[model samples]
Target: MPGAGTSINALPKISLHDHLDGGLRPQTIIELAEPIGFALPTTDAAALGTWFADQADSGSLVEYLKTFDVTTGVMQTREGLVRVAREFVEDLAADGVIYGEIRWAPEQHLTRGLTLDQTVEAVQEGLEAGIALVAQAGSRIRVGQLITAMRHADRGLEIAELAVRHRGNGVVGFDIAGAELGFPAHNHRDAFDFLAKAFMPVTVHAGEADGLESIRGALFDGRALRLGHGVRLAEDIEIGREDEENTYVTLGPVAQWVRDREIALELSPSSNLQTGAIAAWGDDLLDHPFDLLYQLGFRVTVNTDNRLMSNTSLTKELALLSDAFGYDEDDLEVFQLNAVQASFLPLDEREDLADAIVAGFATV
Candidate 1:
């Protein structure tokens, strides 16, 4: 097991739904805060990081989100945004992520004087800088931003236009995050409509905090290219033993459509458990519906929805999944392939990513 991560690291990986604000390094936060005169839960990076993970897993959703109050607090400036984004890529590179899509609601970053364009440009600068640094270190990583609109807020249309305006410049897609239960996808119809007309790719954070109706809304209304934490879609699936030799699986309409259409499920195991997203089934990693959905041929991709909050890297998430589900190199390779296929990049780029993944995996 000591070398398990080493092998997995040698394998190629793609991240589909990682959050930008949610992946900051605590030490970076502490350092960035000192100059800005910001207060923190704890000044020690180790303690503050654990505080975040513990608070997130504290079993109360209200308490969990309070952790973000700290992360987002420090990310309100151009320097903070750039530092976080720069470190975000470096971390992904260290974890062997070849390509990743980092999603965050830009509206959340406007608490300072930064315009939406400023924030996006700052993050892009950081990403490019990080990529350059990694390349200098003899590694490679490709990262794109998924501009998100907060679902509970009324800024979806504004965010959509912002996303469209930056399409070719690091912004690859649009998404909606936050409170999927009440803020149904239909509420963002105008935004989604505009995205559709612009032929922009979109992913929705549904089937995590809510159930099938939310998933339905995401598909019918948001036209999601991928499901952000769509693990709960397993609710529509019934798995029964068929004579101990085979298992019979029945998918209700929603799950069936998702599986048949190969809509990617951006399932983050640790984040899902921390947020109670998998509570309907059980409270353990083994109880996660990730394996079930993958076995049933849904486009199941692994992610770390909130790396800082969940105290995880995508490698750690995949390691945990392997421990829970006995996943091997082949299984891990399949997830990478799924992500490459579902990426917002053009077909040629996607194919190139697939080749890179294949070559990386072959190294082991």
Candidate 2:
């Protein structure tokens, strides 16, 4: 245990699962909306921030997702997208995120006149600007874009082409998000097939809004290297209590494959509780299967699925998990290490990040 004394913000961390549309600064939203004359729930920045949190805590995934309409509304133009992306990276740097991957669907931003390629270029510009600003402030941070396609939509193959086309730019991976219940990963088989041929890294939103079958599809059909909020993978794990302090867990074939292959599970604590992703386990943080999965040797990584919706940061999520499951500094270090290994960056870059984490923890 080290410098995580009530505040882990200073520790070097890697964020593998952050959403661009879900992590906007409240103040920025107000400024961007005024030019477009968009109607918001509130004009005051502080109240608007609280509004997002309160509205998202509705305990239903469908209700919680309704808050994104306001966010995506203002992000139609090049200016709006650029500003949001720039601020997103700056905020991550401030929060001590050494590396982050921001995932967002470009199809949603075509409501205006801009093309999908233009939207991607605009976001990349903002990310580069944000990186320069952070460097000027004497801190270093790197970020990548995970181009996403809504699973409910029929543009899977098109979006997959877009992602591969821009791979040389800022886009690092491809993902199929949106409603995961009825729209399974197999629905986007063409996209996954394209990504596989291109040798692109893929992370799918599975086991969050669905069950083991969804995760299975993500691995087999989607060829996902990671699972977004795969908290529901625990459904395949059966835990039994023996004596007072003795317990046992049995993993089904699906769970066993995920564990044996060391596929990363991006687990967001507060968001999971807010969206009822962990309802079957329990409604409280203590009832989450994150600890169980970690104990069973799963490559678990902590994340903030939606900072604005959950009103939380990476440090806050880790602290909350520590309080709930008694995780200490060493445990936190292991989580960071896992993220470094699972990153989409090159092997050398990942090794450097791991070294930085180890060095930072040493000082702590």
Candidate 3:
């Protein structure tokens, strides 16, 4: 059995919810911005990294989102997107991520002059370069793009089409992100409808800044195969202590359906805490309902929503969860397997990924 004595970084992992723009290296940001005449809060890479973390530490999701303006500011060109995407995959490989799905909105990266297709192609080239670099080092890592649309925008159908157009390329799935409160998934019904007809896989940013109603829209309206930081689904759970040793957790329809249907929850521990996504429960990691959901047999998979903003990696996220819940290596492996099962990859590829994960963990 895998145990806590093994190093978490050495374990093979799958990242289901990492954001591409949000994972840019500070030094890379500085280099990329230099050619574009972009103004940053600071040019010093280390200081700039700290600034991102500090800005995102605010307890409001809206306030936390303001930091993305800076990251996306530098990624408005083909070169910038390529460099950022390449380094993003290298970072994932270094962190022991065997498979990862990088999510970003192409609409957000078109400010400088790049068309949506150009942005996707640029990022795909970078991802391929990064994968090749890893392979050259005698290591293997696979990554796919989850083309995202900003929920507050009306470009969902266009973005969904872009994702489908590149389905045979590096693109694997679609996602809707950005402010989840007022803009329900129904706002992008046409896009979701198109994706449903095209048979494209989807994941939605629900139950993060909103409650059950928003999640319901993501399911019934957006048809999300997975939930992006769906921590607030816990709001639907009612807990009562029967005694010192016994407790009762009553699940609402939303929570019950999510659990019963085996829909994956792309939980980001640090990002969730920083954005107040788990505020209904408490302020610290201990207060997070991740352990509760996991114990209850929900398809809970761990992730780093924004590595730069949260200053975390897949390894660190796993370590933090382990520390908070006293989870052992076996528990971590279970989480990795959950991600593999939920990935948009085809059946044989997912089976291969699962086999690789089990083999990697066996050595630990």
Candidate 4:
């Protein structure tokens, strides 16, 4: 077992909620934008990185999402998409991710005249190339695309079909992200119905910017197998009595269903704080309901929702949690196992991932 000062970065990890557009290297963004004549807040990569993190820390999901404009602006072409996707994989591998599902909306990249299929193909090519590069470097990594749809847009059905079209190629799952308050998952019922008929695994962004009602819709209307930043489900938990000996709580219908059903909560510690997802609890990482949910047997997994925007990696997020909740190596291992079990891969593949994680942690 790992003792004090153990290196969390060396542990094998699985990333289920990372965003492609939101994980770009600042330097790469500068280079890509220059060629496209896209204006940025600054050309200096360090300052640009700081800008993203600072802008996203506004404690409002709507304000936090505006920073995506700069990222998606530079990703309107095939080359841009390929390069960004390639670097995203490399970064994840370096951060000790053995497997990851990179999610992005293809409809947002059509401004440069590329079709949605072409954009998906381009990203797949980049992901494959990144995997090959990692192998050449004597490291191992695997990835899949979680094709996403913008909740506020009318292309949910089209995006769902696009995801299904590429299901066997490189895509693994489907998600709906973007503003969650005004545009609930029920707005995309047609798309969810189609995906359900097609038997595609779905994860929806709910319970972050919105509350229990939105999460309820995501579960029943979208048939979501997992929740993206479903931190707000804690709203359903009522603290009854607390003392030095023990604390009692009650789970409402939504919370009980999610916990009993073992729906994975893709909790992003830093991003949740930045977007005020955990504001109801407190202002710091210690205030997060992750420990409560985990202690209650909820299938909670850690993630870096947007590495660049949050200025974090899976390793950093784990470290923060460890510090906040006094988590040891065993706790970290459980989190990884939860992520492996919740991954969108096939049963055999998820078993392989779980084995790999177990072996890796055994070494430490």
Q: Which candidate is the best by lDDT?
A: 4
lDDT of the candidates, in the order given: 0.89, 0.93, 0.94, 0.95
Q: What would the per-residue lDDT of candidate 1 be over residues 288-313, giving only the tens digit for each residue? A: 99988888789999998888899888
Candidate 2 Cα errors over 4 Å, as ranges: 1-6, 243-245
Query: Which pairs clash (backbone N, Cα, C closer than 3 Å) in model 1?
Result: none
lDDT for residue 114 in candidate 2, whole number 0-100: 91
What lDDT does candidate 3 reach at residue 244? Answer: 100
Of 1 and 4, the candidate ranking higher by TM-score: 4
What overall lDDT, based on C-alpha atoms, would model 3 receive against the true structure? 0.94
Tens digits of per-residue lDDT, candidate 4, 1-364, equal: 3466578999999899999989999999999999889999999999999999999999999999999999999999989998999889899999999999999999999998999999999999999999999999889999999999999999999999999999988999999999999999999999999999999999999999999999999999999999999999999999875778887899999999999999999999999999999999999998999999999999999999999999999999999888888888999999999999999999999999999999999886
By lDDT rank, best first, the candidates go 4, 3, 2, 1
Clashing pairs in 3: none
Estimate the Cα RMSD of every predicted model relative to the unseen true structure: 1.7, 1.3, 1.2, 1.2
TM-score of 1: 0.96
Clashes of each: 0, 0, 0, 0
Query: Which of candidates 3 and 4 is the stronger one according to lDDT?
Result: 4
Off by over 4 Å in 1: 1-6, 60-62, 241-247
Residue 217's lDDT in candidate 2: 94
Per-residue lDDT over 120-157 for candidate 3, one digit per residue giving the tens place of the 0 to 100 score: 99999999999999999888999999999999999999
State the lDDT of candidate 2 residue by residue for 110-200, as single tens digits. 9889999999999999999999999999999999999999999999999999999999999999988888889999889999999999999
